[model samples]
Target: MKSGVFFVAAAAVAWGMGGVVASVLYRISGMGPLAVSFWRAGFGVLVLVLVQLVRRRPVGPRALFPRGWVMIVIGLGLAVYQSAYYLSIAQAGVAVGTVATLGACPILVAIGARLFLGEPLTGRAVLAVGVAIAGLVMIVGGPGEVGPHPVLGIFWALVSAAGYAVVTLLTRRYADRIGSDDVGKTLASFVVATLCLLPLAAAEGLLPASNATVAFGWLVFLGIVPTAMAYTLFFNGLKTVPATTAAMLVLIEPVSALAVAVAVLGERLGLPAVAGTVMLLAAVAAMSVPVRRGSRAAVAAGAAGFDRAAPEPAVAGASEASGDPASAR
Candidate 1:
């Protein structure tokens, strides 16, 4: 079946809960940051495996590791992205960490695409990026959080963004060729991430006791909902949205998180948050609008690549390279 609009919306909805879900898992598991990273991936793989079986799809190793060690290369980046991102948020504080990582990712992805894929950005594109970065700044400082080491958070954020950027570039460059479907690519990332975290999770005593119902439940949700469903929606949406567009659309995640918290979870939305969210969303929307026909073509081409991996002009890419070490962009 043809997929585009539905996938994008679904991904948006699914991933909207990203922060909330991560926070929930943290609350219940009493697990350290590393453990949360490990279980999310491990359980996510398990769920995907089950989903593949239910779909009557054959699960083979063939489509999984094609293009030689490229998956591993990408996977290593994924691991770093995931771990560093979480660490950044944990050590540095979410606001500083989030902005540094997410705000910076698109810039790096654009650069990577230019260098590797021969994609170049126009003046409008550059302006769009700048607007978005400004919005990102507002968002990070919004709600007026103060800390001693904002620099640490910013440092982690940049690292996370860098790592996620690598993941996006790899996916755009190689996913269609290696995996049977985008699911295969996502699975590969999760599997590789799981392996990478096994040792750290083990060392940090991050594994759940299996008998602990609440913790296990949190772990399972981490995988099935945010991990599996989120990626699925992203891939599906990637079919319709341009890589640059999709990456920007992701800015909606933080907004969605705040809305969920305020409306559903009885959290507060301070003036800074509301203002920042508006600015950020506006920036994201502006960044996604293609002023030129070629820019529009980039979006459609990105859609085409879903059916088959075809090259598209570089506008921007949503690299999973977060300042977080654990997340795969």
Candidate 2:
């Protein structure tokens, strides 16, 4: 449980930073969302491939594409979500866009899990989600200029949220079957996603007009930190953490992202936003507390169909308990 929390929280921080960086990139590079999304995935693929080469791990199609069709769907989903999110943040202010997109995710995941996975939606989970969302409302409602086309931005945000929800559920559903080569899985998905976005990005022009070293550096940082590192950690965490809990844990993104925005983007953080941040942290902290062995939360988790201590399959030359398994398609 501790490991799961750590992974998810760390990923959320990286994602939060990435969001701010992306906004900056937009201003400097003048790149469209499609182009930016393409580069993010493209650079991420390079990093993962380098890791594979450095470790001398051969990522064959069989290992990477455990389920060919599903992997494709996951990759497409990733492309859609990433592009849509960038669009949302571009059209909506970061706070509004992030809150709308992320806030909708846990709700969607919870409903999907209940319907498809038979996971019992405990009352405690409901309360936690409600509290987290309230915090989000306060954060976005506080001092901040609303972006142009907020309604359109929100529409795109919802689309991003729905796409992400599908990807999360599919990953969780197939974690056991995908074996434990999380790195390979993430790499494969990025490869496919990059390919999917390439045509659109090319149409929009791939390279930024500015040749500034700092702009390129930011792009690299976006790929390595958020795209590669954050996702690897997130997929590993999802192997043990239930989908709903993982969704809630990611609410940390808005808090951390808003902090970065205030510091770097000159965004205002009023008292209401401060109070909301505190409230949001409390809710996430509460969610992190381990459920008692026989508690209702524990029972609900058991019903969700994953075991934290479950031994991973023998693959990728890794031991059963040595490291976390891949939860990507």
Candidate 3:
């Protein structure tokens, strides 16, 4: 349990730095969001592939392909999530975009699971969603300090949140079939995302020639550290921790991003926005707390039933696994 908590916390801290890093890249390189997304995914795949090679693991087509179309869907979802998230930051400012997207993800995922995955919408989940949405309204409607286009940014951020929710659900459902090799799954999905975004990035052109070196450095940092390493830690932790616990621990990402935005980027929030952020985070925490006794038993029964209906394992792996659906960005 301690190891699980530690790994999750470490992943959160790494992910928390992602926004700040991207913000710096935007300011320094003047690269478009799509361009940044392309490089991040591209370099991330390289990093994962290299790691797998170094570890002497299989990286062949047979090993990398996910069962059926799961990887394709996850790949497309990732492309959308990454692009929209960066665009949200570009339009709304790092602080608001990160908070809105990350803050809303768990609530969206919870609602999605209940509706499609046959998970129950417990009273706790309902309250959490309500409070979270209320908080979102406050953040969106409150004064805008992050960027000039708050509404547009919020829209994109919500899109990112939805994409992330979809990916999370699909990954969890297909995890056993996706194979036991997390690195291979991640690399394959990232490669798909990279290919999907390549054209858009090309249209925008690569990093500015003058800032090429510095920009490339930051892109590599974004890819290797936050994107690759963060997910590695997250997946490792998921081996021991319950998905619920890991989900809650990852809330640290937004808090870390918020701190960096204020301290490093000179961002500020109004009273209402601050209150809204608090409410949103509180809702996430409330929903993540483990239910006790009777409710726990009920949840266990539901899970057991769901497992019975799920397909037999297509590959060998841990039953419960978690990955940062947004590439930890």
> Regarding TM-score, does 1 or 2 come out ahead?
2
Candidate 3 local lDDT, 155-262, one digit each (tens): 998998787776666665665677656677778778788899999799987665458899998889878977678766665564544443445566656556555556
TM values, all candidates = 0.81, 0.85, 0.77
Model 2, position 262: C-alpha lDDT score: 71
Please give, for residues 2-36, the per-residue lDDT of candidate 2 as tens digits. Answer: 79778888888787777667666666877755776
- CA lDDT, every prediction? 0.61, 0.71, 0.65
Model 1 root-mean-square deviation: 5.3
Candidate order by lDDT, decreasing, is 2, 3, 1
Q: How many pairs of residues collide in model 2?
A: 0
* Distance from true location, Cα of 173 in model 2, Å: 1.2
266, model 2: CA deviation in Å? Answer: 5.9
- State the lDDT at 32 in candidate 2: 59
lDDT of 1 by residue, 1-329 (tens): 12443454455555555555555555555566678778888999888888777877666666567664766777787688767776666666555566667778777877776566445555655676777766655644532343357777667667777777776666666655555366666777678889998998888887554436887776777687767887766655554344555566666666665565566657665666567677767766675555568765764453443435543210011111121122322
